[model samples]
Target: MTTWRPDVLGDGYEQLELPLGTDPDGEGEISATLVRYQPPSTDLPDRAVLYVHGFTDYFFQQHLAEHFAARGYRFFALDLRKCGRSRAPGHTPHFVTDLSHYDAELDEALRVVREEVGGGVLLAAHSTGGLVLPLWLDRLRRRPGGVAAAGIVGLVLNSPWFDLQGPSYLRNVGTAAVDIVGRLRPRALIPLPKTEAYGRSLQCDGWRYDLDWKPLTGFPVRFGWLRAVRRGQAVLHRGLDIGVPSLILRSGASRFAPRYDASVDTVDAVLDVRQIARWAGCLGNRTTIVPIDGARHDVFLSTPGPLAEAFRELDLWLEWLDGADEADTSGSRTEADDSDDSDDSATVSVLHRLTGEHA
Candidate 1:
């Protein structure tokens, strides 16, 4: 049986530990944590949302949970093994040789959410988690009943890391070098220049959370982790059909800065937004991509103006998803109808209003 206790987020939030028996990375025993928001109101919606945080991050976005809860969803977040509440003394933070190792915890988290909500789920992820979910969902699609049986209705990705950021050589020669070094010394930290621009943008802008869990300078990037991420991106580039439509949100521009500045709050200081747009179509099945103008790497963490615009776009897509479901129920829509030009044009119109660009 699973047990849940009050989470560090305090009132209305609780966490359940998901034990994975042994650590594949030999970091002793390790586990993941599943957090849920239990609102005071008795009435609940049939739908639920499962959120996964990005690299060097945890589920401390209380307002994000509240937003989903306000929409009547039973919101849940997963801190993957050795991340956030799941990290142990001996464990290297967010270290894993292969991304697929996360499957155990993700599978467990989905099961619990399905058992509690007894309805469809919307998978939400950010950055690295964004990359992880699509790969997982593609694997899930090949199962007996596929995503529908798993209760996954759609996906919402916040600035997904679709490709390795930087110049072409990094993805080519650098990847080969990383694979060799990573296999040789899996826990060796990659010597990356220290920067706190992304973290500073959040704290200096009035958002407050535990710095220890999500430090300003961020955690050291392990060679193994980077190798795993690159491998995942390579697979993603090949193409994947997650079996459900996905809504991808990204910033309009990318500005890589070594130090915090006013501009850090206005653009994606972590990743190249163009890469996100380029690889978005690789996700396959009816994908909708929206670039939130003046937004950060994490669109939800952006400033008020862009933040609201991001949410507005998200709501529009959610409404469209619901309409499609309704149409399916009324027997007026078929799988082939998912490619309707009229609906596609309407989506483009929504994008034009949000970003002032054609889809």
Candidate 2:
């Protein structure tokens, strides 16, 4: 049985625990958590959004869930196996030798969401999570009569790590070396320089988040993990026809050199934003790429101005998805309140703003 508790941030969020269960590999019993938000409603939602966090991160964006909820959508976020709220005493945070191993947990989480919400789901993923989902969906498409392709209506990727960021030679030679090292010492730590620049950009340091959930310092990047990520990236580079509408968001520029400067706040200093923009079209038939100026790697968590613009762009994309305005793909219109009840005023206002409505 899974037990749920309110998140410490007090943002109308809950954390779920999957108690010790038999580890499929006979390693031991495995435990995990599913961070969820069910939008205070008795009736089935019209739609649902499943959010997946990136490497060295967990579900912390409650406002994103509230935004979806006000739009009459149920929202749920998973802290994948061995990550964040799911990390156990013996388990490493965000440590997976192969990305495909996540499919089982993801599939199970989807099943739970489908049972509870009873609507088509939109996948919203960030960074490494963005990389994992598309690859999983592609494999699912190959399966005869797979549920994933049918259940997922759309996709939203935030600064996906599509390719390695360093020089071509490094990626070529380093990846091979990493693979060998992974095979020999999967747990060996390869220290990568850390910077407070990314954290400062989002203003998350002094916030309500628990440092344990998302450390001020990121997790170590091991040879096995990098190799696994590279393998996933290779598959993404090959191309995936997800057959669903997708919205890809990234910073206008990228800076990967090892220097902590103010530019880190305005551009993506972690991954290659240009590569993400270049491959955004490969997602599906109806794909939209929106590059936000002065945005951080995670646009929604950017500074006030850029963050608002990012949300506005997202609202417009949602409007486009609803086919509200064929000519207005930019989602710039204000939303009109169709609901009469004052009790729902706050919810409605949030929904409108999320859908690009001002009022």
Candidate 3:
């Protein structure tokens, strides 16, 4: 991998530009940015993480990197083509007619991580990224033995978008309309109910990210993009056997409001938590679903009380994975932990009470 120069994150982070050929959207000469976090010490032993951001998002979570780096894992994040740092001039920001097209960058990024980081990498993603990685992992399991397939030993999802939010009939009918419109006019904009509640809670007067990229209300929803997301969600609903141990964290409650309220401070003001809890089981066996009491749409970006809880839960899950990996190596792993599964033998655990020292 060629590390030409410094990335947007600067300092310890550097960017590797992957030439992905032509963009199907006709944006021309496509490339994706792989932001690598250089560990302070070259002696840090065998562990790494690859973080994928959601729609209209990029890997800007320094806290997340700190969490993993402190635990001795080299960290990297992908700015998927046409999003964040990878968005070139004349390219439609975060526009993709097919989610499967992302497999190219995702595969390349994983390969680079495995080669550069030199260890089993944990694939962690948030929101729409949560949906994207699971689908990719499911495909990875079916691959004929490759680095991208073998490198990702585990997955940690932050509030995955399993199903569409809003009313049932609307989700059904609206998606149908979106499918038709997307096929006809791929770039057509969907008329959506604008809600700034989640934005107010997250951005809070530019407390965090670059508003131009992330935005206070988020990027506009495109017909083809939503259709692609729905197609992925449908595949998820049909159940995917994503072969590796996974952890999903979400807000236990969701409160959607037109105007800002105190409730938005603690709840998931974006997607429905019930839908996440309902379809999380479809991600195959050996999945742990955690519901943070006061987490926002993104669990890691939650407030102090619940964000700490989310991190603690993540740490606990990481420990469980180490044990599970040891068991697998010793040939003591069970059928539920199989690499390829055709049945709904998933063990979805919800940790309500803090256990052991975690309490």
Top model by TM-score, which number? 1
> lDDT of all predictions, in order shown?
0.86, 0.72, 0.79
Report the lDDT tens digits of candidate 1 across residue range 1-359. 97899999999999999999899889999999999999887687889999999998999888889988877689999999999999999888899999999999999999999999899999999999999999999999899998888999889999999888778986798899999999899888889899988989998888887777788898999899999999999999998889887888878778999999899999999888778777887887767777777999989999999999888888777766776753342231112112222343344454444333345
Report RMSD (Å) for each prediction in the order shown.
Answer: 4.6, 8.7, 4.9
Q: Please list all clashing residue pairs in model 1, or write none if there are none.
A: none
189-237 per-residue lDDT for model 3 (tens digits): 8877777787787766244777777876778899989999999999998
Poorest lDDT segment (10 consecutive residues) of candidate 3 = 335-344
Comparison by TM-score, 2 against 3, better one? 3
Model 3 misplacement above 4 A = 146-149, 325-359
How well does each candidate superpose onto the true structure, as a TM-score?
Answer: 0.92, 0.84, 0.90
Query: Over the stretch 235-323, how does candidate 2's per-residue lDDT look in tens digits?
Result: 77777766566777777677764545667777786787766755655554456666777788877777777778788777777775776
lDDT of 3 at 59: 83
Best candidate per lDDT, number? 1
Backbone clashes in model 2: 2
